[model samples]
Target: MPLLPTPSYTTSLLLSNGHVQTLYPPLFRKVAILDAERVRIATHDDDFLDLDFLPATAEAACPNADGVRARPLVIISHGLEGHSRRKYVRGMAACMNAAGWDVCAWNFRGCSGETNRALRMYHSGVTDDLHTVISYCAERGYARIALAGFSMGGNQILKYLGEHPAAVHPAIVAAATFSVPCDLVGAAKVLDRPSNSIYMRYFMRSLKEKMRKKKELHPELNIEGLDDMKTFAEFDNQFTAPIHGFRDAMDYWQRCGCGQFLSALRVPALLVNAKNDPFLSPTCYPVYTARASEFLHLEMPVTGGHVGFIRNHEDGCYWSDLRAVEFLRQHL
Candidate 1:
């Protein structure tokens, strides 16, 4: 398929800048999560992933005139330090439900408002957790499935598809992602900048707090010197790599970066990474991979910061959510 044309998302004059665009939604956007029935599924390793499901309304669940199946599922993955209830995830779930699809917004381990039981937690790569989610959905008899993810979760979707093109469930037909940090090595560099210190501190604070709680359960966990760590390099090297079975931060970034896996996606996938995303590196935009691949449709908009694609809509859906629903509906 041809690459997507440049999409338009106009922020207010006050929010035109990347940082403002990124910060406005979380600081101000409010999208109520209605009728989200939380389901907990146990992992093989005894860890758990929490999924918030919004089933398609009965009016929207009927088969199409063409007799296409009803109840197609869209599984959405959240960003780093994010959960199923984040505005981005909740908004997309609502949009999908409105468009006649069931939505499953999954929380990465330890991100579901409770620290995960296992000693280890989720990371940038970790497609195995996604596999467990997909497989669980498949077993539940959903005949059609699509995927949507943001940032770290987006990287996981691409890596999951690329790592196992032939191994993907037949039910999964399409995918859409926004603001992905696909190139982890470059993303680390981008996050280390002085301009991004706000984001760095916010994330480090959240991660460190989780570690403090996790330490209570797994006392062997080292929570020392977390106060000194400021960047992903410092924290990932000290904690994430050792706990998640990587040699170090560099090895984790190298092995887990989704840039190396884009060309291998079998399902029709839309990756819309904004050019002005403050949280991403230029390497995160895989122009070559998208050009070479038949399935991965990479759309680089001029402005969408991280997961923020604010749209002035009555339904409270953002531009990113609407765009994903637009792309995914074509396949469903």
Candidate 2:
């Protein structure tokens, strides 16, 4: 892909206390490093379902006891069938918290074992809930906000950042994503592989259980037809697309995919994935771009499995935690 052009000096905003700069050295200059002292904080459940939001203390050095000023906030979003407590999310949250940042691991609509009340479901590229959370922070006067997501959540973050661009809340300084499925169709095809059956089955079980509960709550909606359907495609077609207003599964994936939207991104965003991530097929990796855009960068590593950047596999000192916080520190 063509290298993105560097951003020119633009209007700058300076906050009091010599903190907060609108521009920074290029993202490439920030080396991925690791940190410790990540602390686990409080967790809360969203209003709808057992969906829990784990808001951890990313940087205890800065406190929010007064609800006024604190360290910048980094919202963590998990991948499909994952939760805020996942090792990756927790690790990253703690790492950033140790570095003086507040962190919250957002549980997607119904991923935390609780069913959302609304008929509309969560999907790649849906930004309503994310926008809601960011606006909540902005309204509270948080000067800086950052986002980090993995796998499917990565896709959602990328789409939101790219689509909103100039419209995004000014507090959002930077965003980073890992194992993002830029092309949903490509990912779906890859997940259909025989080796991926285990992963697919696990997601399918969680999804069907949620649907069964929804059916129980609203007995009028006949969902018995879903009993025979197996694949993620069929499940999405029967439930996700129709409820979310998509014409079909293919349409949903196309509209929700992040690949076509990167050129519009305005925030400093980092996209990272390993060549071995199980979710991506060879065709899904971004192609060389002819136009250099300053808004986005792609960091493709040779290892890092699907959302599994197991830090220092040998010494047990993985680098994900540090990479996450450093990315935030660079832009926020």
- For model 2 the local lDDT of residue 275 reads 67
The C-alpha local distance difference test score for the whole of candidate 1 amounts to 0.88
Worst ten in a row by lDDT for model 1 = 60-69
TM-score of 1: 0.95
lDDT of 2 by residue, 174-261 (tens): 9878888898988999888886776778788888888888886667765877767668799888888888898999999889998888
lDDT per residue as tens, model 1, 224-278: 8988888888889988999989999999999998889888888899999888899
TM-score of each: 0.95, 0.79
